[model samples]
Each structure stands twice: as C-alpha cells, then as structure tokens.
Target chain A: MTTTTKNNEPIITVRGLRNTFGEQVIHENLDLDVRRGEILGVVGGSGTGKSVLMRSIIGLQTPDDGEIEVLGESMIGRSEDEAKNIRRRWGILFQNGALFSTLTVAENVEVPIREYFPYIRPPVIDEIASYKIAMSGLPANAGPKYPSELSGGMRKRAGLARALALDPELLFLDEPTAGLDPIGAAAFDELIASLQKRLDLTVFLITHDLDTLITICDRVAVLADRKVIAVDTIPNLLALDHPWIQEYFNGPRGRTAALSHKEGAAA
Target chain B: MAANGAGKARSSGVLPTEFISRTTSRDMADVNGTSDDHQGESVYRVAGALTITRAATTQREIDALPDPLTIDLSEIDRMDTVGAWLVYRAVRDRGAKVVGASRDEVSLLHQVSEFDVPARVRPEESSSFTRVLTELGEWVADAGSTLLGLLGFFGATLIGFANLIRRPKRFRVNAVVQRFDVVGVRALGIIGLMSFLIGIVIAQQGSVQLEQFGAEVYTINLIGRITVRELGTLMTAIMVAGRSGSAFAAQLGTMKITEEIDAMRTIGVSPIEALVIPRMIAAVIMMPLLAFWAMLMALLGGGIFVWLSLEIPPLTYVQRLQEVTPITDLWIGLIKAPVFGFIIALAGCFQGMLVQGNSEEVGLRTTTAVVQSIFLVIVLDAVFAVFFSSIGWR
Candidate 1:
C-alpha cells in the first residue's frame, strides 16, 4: 500500500474509501494512488463499485469515510464552488458519453473552458475545441452538429474532446469503449494512450473490456468488495493469485498473455 | 381494501387472513404465494360471503346461512383506514349481511360500512348534489385563482416584454426566432388554406340567403366585415392555439421531464430565457402576420363568391371594400392577433412548465393549455369589443 513517489509526490491519493447504501455495504475499504502522467485502469464486474470509486474520487459522490486528496487539496464535504474549482483540474467522460443534446459538438467541448477558464480568449478556446475534435478522429465539420446527429463512436469522441477541453491534469474515463464497434474501440484506446502522453495526464479508466485494459493502461486496479484487491502493472496483475483477477485476465476467449506482451512491447 | 381481499379470496376460493406491506399501496391481495406477504392482505369468510380482516388470525367464528352471506367483523386485528374502507366498500354494495360481532368491530363496521347504512342509500343523489356544490365552489375558487394568476402574469409579461424591447439580451433571440418560424411560417399554409375555404363557404351561404331578396351585393359587406373583424382572426387564432400552442406545451414539457431544463440551469442558462421568452416573442410577432395573410385570403375567396353570386367583378368588390371598411378596422383586428398569440404561447408555456409524471401529463397539459387559451382568446375578444364600443370605435 506504499504510494511514495520517486521524485514528485502523487497528485491523487485515496485510502480506505467506503460507501454503503442503507444496510447493503458496497465497499468496506478501498485504497488507490494515482501519480502524474500515468494511465490507470480500474476493472471490475458489474455492481462492483468501479463507477462509485471514480465518482468518489472526482468529488461527485461522497463516500461514508475516506481521505481523498486531489492536487494536494482535501475534497470531503467541500462547498459546490470549492468542488467546482477542484473539478476544473479534472475531466470525466461518462459511461453514456453524456453530451448535451442541445449544444453543438464544438459548444459541448467549449463548456468546461467557458466555465473554468473564463479569462481565456474565445478564439483560442474555439481553436482548441476544433483541434481536440480533429484529434479524436472526428471531422472538422462535425463541430457544428449536435450530439444526436453524431454516430456512437463520434459522440464518444466528442465527449472525450469536451473532457480534454480544459487541458485537465487528471482524466476519468467511465466505459469509454462501451457500445462502440471493435475498430472504433481500438482507435479510442489509441487516442487515450496518445492523449495521456500528449497532455502528461493521470488517467483513471473504468472498464470491463480486457482489450482496453491491456492496450492503454500502464497500471491496473481491480475493484472487488468495494476494495482494491490488486493494483499493479498488467504483468504483475496477471501474476496475482486472486481467482477473479486470474479468471478475468486469462479467462475463456482470451487471445493469450503473450499477445498482449507482444503488443505492449511493440508499443 | 375489502373488495380486493374478497375478490382475491373468492376468485381463489381460499380463506386467507394475513396482512402484509407492499411496495405499492394498491388493492392487491393474494391467497397464493405470489400474493403472499408481498401483495399485502387477504380475505376470510365469517359465515359464507367473504370479509376482509387485517388480523393475522381469526378471533371468533360464527355460523350463518349462505343465503344472506353474513360476514363477521369481530376478529379483525389491525386496521389502516384504506384497508377498512376497501372492506366496507366490497361488502356494502353486495347486499350481504354484515353482523358486527364485537363492540369495536360493530363501531368499526358502522363507521366504514355503507350497506343498509340509510345515510348512503341516496349516495348518488348526495354525490351529485355534492358534486354540483363542489364544482361550484371549485369553479369559484378556480376563477379567483385564475384571475389573480392572469393579472400577475399579464403585468409580469408586459414588464418583461418592455424590458426585452429596451434590452434585447434580456431574452434569447434564437429561441424567439425558432418559435416565430415554427408558429408563424409553419402555420401560414394551413391557415391561408382554411381561411380561403371559410371565405368561400361564408360567401356561398350569404349569396344563397340574399339571392331571394335580390340583395346579393350586400353579401360583400357581410363577408368582408365578418372575415376582417372576427371570423378570420378568431378561426386562425383557435387553429394556431390547437396546433402550435399544444406543440409548444408538449415540446417544452418533454424537455422539462428529460432534465434539459435542469441542464440549462446547470450551464447557467435560464429555462425561461432559453425557452419561454423566445416562444412568447415569436408568437407575438408572428400572430399579426398570420392574421394579415388570413384576412387577404378570405377577401380573395369572398371575391370569388362576389363574382359568382352577384355578377359583381372582383375589382368592384375590392373598390367597395375600400369604401365600406376603414383601414383602422383592419389595423384593430391585426393588432389583436398578436395579443391572442401572446396569450396562447404564455398559456402553453405555463402549462408545459406545470407538467409532471409521464407522457399522459404532456397530452393532458397540451389539451388544457389549448382549451384555456381559446377560452381566454374569446373572453379577451369580448373585452376588446366592449372597450372599442365604449370608445365609439365600433
């Protein structure tokens, strides 16, 4: 559970995070450490509190008891404006790609910037929105189209574009490849890796897709019983003695560990 | 509650007497496991006919003939008011003999029962009388409330519109323009067509009526005055209210239900500014234009009537119209159209904002908004007529 940094301190640290709904306790104690400039993947079964953990980290859902430090600031029971200030440093891509239907794709991308960086010139923001949209592999003309007009892949890309709009240091991706075709999902995974490198961002991604986990993640966190049973590099996670973790990584229909190793080595 | 219990017991032919709490407080009772503690309560028979009891077990059993279908209420343990009411309602209407076996049970049965309850024999008559009185009271209260709301809304709208005119950013231009195009431009074709046909019908009818009297030329004046002053404007407003007003309500209501309004607020955009102001401005601006178009189409249609009925040329009817109807009259009618438009849009928006629950609510609010708008339009028209008459403009 030691999370000491080599030189720079960890930007985000969570310890003994717990959340319960009535009598049914979701998580008893969960711990995580996210360093700067690393993509961390959180993989879990349905109802295993992956999203809840992400939400708690982002200060969207308050845990029953936990210490969450984002950018050296405590986030428990903070006022809305204070939390919003904290949120300005972080970006979240919701599972459903929660884009506002009324706003055009470009406007959607411009929202966080408009909210957080009001001092930034409109033209510069617009320029960045367009660039992010293009970087996500969406057409330039797609900026003027509403969320509803875009394809599923395009919508997710647009959502990612919006998430990256403020140049956030930390990014949370909730099921980023959900409802996407395999080609699009792979492209999105590549985009996530590239973005992480480009922005020097600490990414916390929640996903059920093993391909996504093996593809872009530098480290993986397995959430079970509302706790992080394992948090390590992909190779180390695969070597762990947990039944669910082993079954998850080396389960039926898996292409084999060597294939992932080859891809990681190639990258 | 009783009815449900009896129905459940009678249907399954099982005497079930356990009460259970359900998620939804419905008239649900089960003799089977499906209706177990999950569905709430079941019914038990005292003698023959089934009676509902909230008790876990029966206290006493009585023997009575199946002919009268006697139900004993003595053994009932716990009671909620709804459960008791349900039981009473089930047994009361069936002419079944309900014998109160204990003092508390008799009092409970008497308190809730309507069968052989002499006071309830004229229930229909009493309900109808009560309905009439209730409706009267409700109508009076509603009228008072509506009048107050109308006054408040009218003052607020006038102030808002005035403020908007002074400062355009006070309202959403995109919303207004969108609503205007939707209300006015979209409705133009249908309103024009309907007005034309109405003119034709009025002219034909007037011509037939005047033909015997050799006064067919007078049909020009009749059709002109009616179409210009009342029929054209009224019909067009009613049509638009039914079409566009209801549409506004449904669209806004659906948006409200879907949390788009909340999203707008979260983004620091006012729902009123983003939605209502635009619609109100659009409707007010477009109504007069639609009314003017309607007036022209009606006149043209009447021209056709004049040509067919009296052999009066279209040009002559036009000339006569200039002589008979003052431009002020046309202006007065045109001016009222936008007012009608404002009212319709406001009503629609108000009702739209009031909508809750589901799709049924959207439909209900849409209907209510249209009906209310049309009624207000007619009342306003009457008020306008009276005002005009008092001013010697009539």
Candidate 2:
C-alpha cells in the first residue's frame, strides 16, 4: 500500500521475444517494459510459460529470438564474462528455494558476497550475511541450519536472504508465495514490498497468489496465448474485457482477496 | 587565528582521504569533502560509492576513525545495504551521528539498523581432541545399533516370507522375475569375463612354479581345486555385491526420500514384500547358478591356457581336473553361494531402509551397502573355509 515514486524509464525492456522448447512454443513476439522501482506481478494459468519467461529474461534459457535490455545492457547473445557486471545487479529466487544442500543458510548468503567481493574480510561478510538473514525474517538461529533442516517456508526465506545479499538493484522472484500458508504468504508479500521500497529495487515477480496481486503489485502482466495479453493495475485490468483476465480477477477466490485487501486498507 | 587553524586541520583531514570515486573505475584517489567546524567536534567525510565491492576498504576506514564521530555521506554517489550496514554499525556502536545522507540512503541505513540481531555464522565446533573422541564414540554406538537394526530387518524379512507363504496369492511373480533379470541375467557377461581372466592368470603362474620341479601337470590340480572350492563363488559374490547391492540401496534410498515407500504403506502394500523380498529371493536362487557357471568358465579358461602355453592337450587337462577336483569341492562352493547372496541383499536393503533426509543419504547408504556386504561376505567365507576344512571336505 506504500507507493514509492517510481521513475518512468524502464529498468528492463523486452521486445520481439520468442522462446520454444523442441516442438512446443512457449512464447512469441512478447513485449514487456518494467519501469524502475516497481513490483510487477506476472500471472497466468498453469503451463502458460510464466517461469519460462522469467528464465528467458535471466538468461537461464536462451530465446530463439529476442532483444532484452536490463539496466541499459543488452542481455542477448552476451558471454558470461561480458554479463558478469549486469548479473551482479540482479538476484533470483527460484521456487522451492533451490538453496545449496550442503551449505548452511548463513553460508549460502555469504556465497554471493564472497564471490563478488573477495577482498572483504570474513567478519564483515558474516555480519552482512546475518543482517540479510534477519532482514528476510529468518530467526538468528536459522543461520547455522542447512536447507534440509528447515521447513519449506524457512527455506524460502533463506533463499530470499541470499538473493538480497548483494543489495541487488533488480530482483526476480518465481512464485514467492506459492507454497506458503495464507498468513505466511502475506508476511512474505509485506517483506518484498518493504525491501523493494527501502532498496529502490525493480522486482519482476511471478506468482499465483491473488492476495499478493491485489495487495502489493504496482502492476500485473497477464500471460495468455503465448504472449502477455495485458499489463496494467488490477483495477484497470479488471475493467478490460479479456476473458481470462476477467475470470482471474473476478473469480471467487479473487473476490475474497480483493475484499480482504480493501478491509485491511480501510482499517 | 583559531578559525584559520581549524580550517587547516579540516583540509588536511579531508584532502588525504583515499577512495574509489567512479563506479566502473577501480582507481583510488582523493575526493572532495569538508570536516568539522570551529568547534572541537570530530567529523569524518565518506566519499565515492559506498557499496559491497569496496566494503573491505570502507570497513577499515570506518574502524580507524576516532570515537564521538559524525559521518558525512554527502559525497557518496551510490550506497547499498553493505555500505548502510557499515555506517549503521558505526553509529550504533560508537554513538556516531550521520549527516548529509540522501533520503534513499537514510532509509537504507535505517532499514539495516532495524535488522540488528546477533547471529552465529557457523555452528560452534568443539576442540579437535574432544571432537575426535566424540566422533569415535558415536561411530562405535552407530555400528552397534546398525548391527541390531540389520538383525531386526532380517526378522522382518522372515515374517514377510511367512506371510507370503500363508497367502500364496500375495506372492509377486513379476517382481521376482524382474529382479532375477537384473541381479542374475544381466551380470553374466562381466562375471564370466572376470572369472575367465582370473583362471588364466592362476594357471599361467602355477605352471611356471611347477615347471621348475618338472611337474607342470600339477597346475591343472591347482586351477581346478581353487576355482571350484574358493575363487568361483567368492569372486562372483564380490562382483554381485559391487553391482547389485549398491543398486538396491540406491533405488530404495531414493524411494524413501521421495516418500514412495510411505505411499505404498498408506495403500496397504508392504514395501518389505513388494521391494525387498523379490530382490532377496532372486539373489538367493541365482547365486549358486552363477557360481556354478563361473566355475565352468574358469576351468575352460585354464584348459585353454594350458593347451596353448604348456603344450598340454585340452583332453589331458580335463582328465587331470576331474581327478583332482572332488565333488565335495563343488558342493562347498555352491553351499557358500546362497549364504553370500542373502547377506549381500540384506546389507543393501537394510542400509537403504535406514536412509532418511536428502538425496545425499542415498549415495552414502549405497556406499555403505557395498562395503558392508563385501566385508561380511569375506568374513563369512573365512568361517566357511574353517568349517569345511574341519569337516574334512578338503
């Protein structure tokens, strides 16, 4: 609900993006522009390539054809060495956490810092890691525990801690609240919103949680028919006559989410 | 004079300050800044980008500054959480006041200060001597419990067998046959080649020693007795333990991790009967047959080597083998085979059932299965050797 003044200049620009896996086409001629300092929630039905689009932007999956400009750097066809500087500016949190199984939560957070700034002393890195871990809402004791030792929710927080370790300008969260309970999901959404505001981050979020969309997202982009069908605020999107978008926002669960959001805001 | 002296002191303090000014450039140089006024107050100016990449240098500078400090951040081009943390920690610990920070930088510093929980980076490790002693004690206790667990598993397997016998309709014919194809049929080629090569090496070595005594024909006796009574079943057991025992542990461990075994239990299907029993039965039934086949292959290899290298005919070699290798030697080898097979399968399945937690447990359990089964097989073979000798079977 706290709206930071976002700039008009796009932090990320995608045009004519096409992606395919063997015979299956996931996207074609997709266009998206994520403005600076805004949390853009991406939503679609299952198997509509929400994750695939995220992967394409992060350079994990190379698109057959596209132009991707992130922070004014062309992302397509760039080698790893060339992408290192740009890569450092963004952090990604995969679904299910995808934490390193062997390292503890604190150690996982330290990994990115150590890799980027090897000259930093161990004590400083440790202090920074603890700060990030606490900022992500994990308990202090959860630092020493491995990924396997924690619950699904704790693991996701640990993953977020690692993602925010370097104070990345851009953050990519794939289903940040997918497996969380209702209360836990709301807390996570609040954390994301607060962190984005404090750090001036441009968040590209993929989610299925209606409450998340209604509560925190500055804008929602709908993926359908192998491309983003519409991109606008939830109310504006609801006004449109797109069938999928209509059902998505006005559905039973969506109505309940909207009502609760309104009630919470009123209170 | 006082104002001029304060101006000189402030200029000297700010002029020599070394910092990286540009984001892309790594060059360190003096940047613009102004310190405290005419009063005796102490102020430190931080210039350039205060980010993670320059955290080491910034931390050192922050630590070296005098107490009752006022940090000036007006010259900072960029600032991140790491930089904010550095500034926040100084202010909190040293009671320093921060001035001239941008709105965004002030918020970032405030946010970093809010997360001021003391967290241990790693688990506390005990002293090396105590750790070693503790590890040794834990290992012994683990081994003791593992032995007891294996015995309990054996009892469970026996109960499973009894239940299947009581209800013959519950027997899984397809599962057992599939296990037979995996544990027995597929292992034929490698086991055969290994036994054949071992036979040739033994014959070649034995003939050389016998030739010195002008009794080269005795090599046939050595090859026949050793292959039939000891090497055939023992080597085959070792190979099967390496190949099939490790696989059983890995498969079952994966199933346990994925909760497939739990699902089976919920559906009223016994994993012991569905998974372990089929593998156990197949190993028990196939070991003696594989051992017998290995013994024949070894004899054929030795026969061929003797015929080619020693100029002895295949017929003569076969006749000598028949005379030296008694029926009791074959019985001894075949009798040991089923016992070895049972131990291998039990060790594998036992380790697999013990696996919990992540996929790493599967790899560890698989390794333990192969090692424990092979060690038990060798120990049991030694016992069989003593018992057979005492019974005058040799």
For model 2, residues B1-394, the per-residue Cα lDDT tens digits are 0001101111112312122111111111111224334245455677777888788988888787777666777666677788888888887778776666554555567677779899988888999999999999999999999999999999999999999999989999999999999999999999999999999999999999999999998999999999999999999999999999999999999999999999999999999999999999999998998999899899989989999999999988888788999999999999999999999999999999989998888999999999999999999999999999999998
lDDT of 1 by residue, B43-155 (tens): 34433322222111221222112323334443443332223433444454434444333332333344333212121101133467888999999999987886687667667
True contacts kept of each: 0.00, 0.54
Candidate 1 chain B lDDT trough over 10 residues, lowest sum: B114-123
Q: Which stretches of candidate 2 lie over 4 Å from their true place?
A: A1-5, B1-43, B66-68, B207-216
Error of 2 at B171 (Å): 0.9
Q: Which whole-number lDDT from 0 to 100 does residue A231 have in model 2?
A: 90
Candidate 1: which stretches are off by over 4 Å? A1-267, B1-135, B155-167
Considering the two chains of model 1, state its CAPRI-style docking category: incorrect
Q: Put down candidate 2 lDDT per residue, A77-188, tens digits, no spaces.
A: 8988989998888999999898998899999999999998898889878999999999999999998888989998999999999998888889999999988999899999
Local accuracy of candidate 1 as per-residue lDDT tens digits, A145-220: 7776778889899898888765566889999998999888888999888767544567889987778888788889
